[model samples]
Target: MQDWAGVFIPLVLFILLSPGLLFQIPGKCRIIEFGNFHTSAISIIVHAILFFSLAAIFLVAIGVQMNLGP
Candidate 1:
């Protein structure tokens, strides 16, 4: 197996920071509107969920690949 620490450490840090970085960005489009606390929280939650799901997929794929290797 791969070293779990090495595999997961950066993912943990990135997962923590990226979603909040959205708040620092400012602009509006037809799809996204930046605004008050409630809306911002909802958007962040959605982003976190999306990020977590993608991360899980990647981690699972990596684990499978590692398991299949010598």
Candidate 2:
């Protein structure tokens, strides 16, 4: 019974927050290298915090409630 916001919002957020997926912004932290790919630990943590905050805000704004139990 959920609308588009239920699915679409999280999907977009996931893509945007996933490290080395869409964009790579290596801030002051050292970049970890494996072969040709590189990513920063600080950047990943920042993205995770940002994602959680945004997701919470969006959920509240969209009036989506969660049921924890059956």
Model 2 spans > 4 angstroms off: 21-37, 62-70
Residue 16 lDDT in candidate 1: 49
When summed lDDT is taken over every stretch of 10 residues in candidate 1, the lowest stretch is 21-30
lDDT digits (tens) for residues 1-70 of candidate 2: 4355656667889887676665555543444322324457876887688788888788876566544455
lDDT of candidates 1 onward, in order: 0.49, 0.65
How many collisions between residues are there in candidate 1?
Answer: 0
User: In angstroms, what RMSD does candidate 2 have relative to the true structure?
Assistant: 6.9
TM-scores of all predicted structures: 0.42, 0.56
Candidate 2 lDDT score at position 8: 68
Q: Give all candidate RMSDs, comma-separated.
A: 6.4, 6.9
Model 1: CA > 4 A from native = 1-17, 20-29, 32-39, 62-70
lDDT (0-100) at residue 20 of candidate 2? Answer: 65
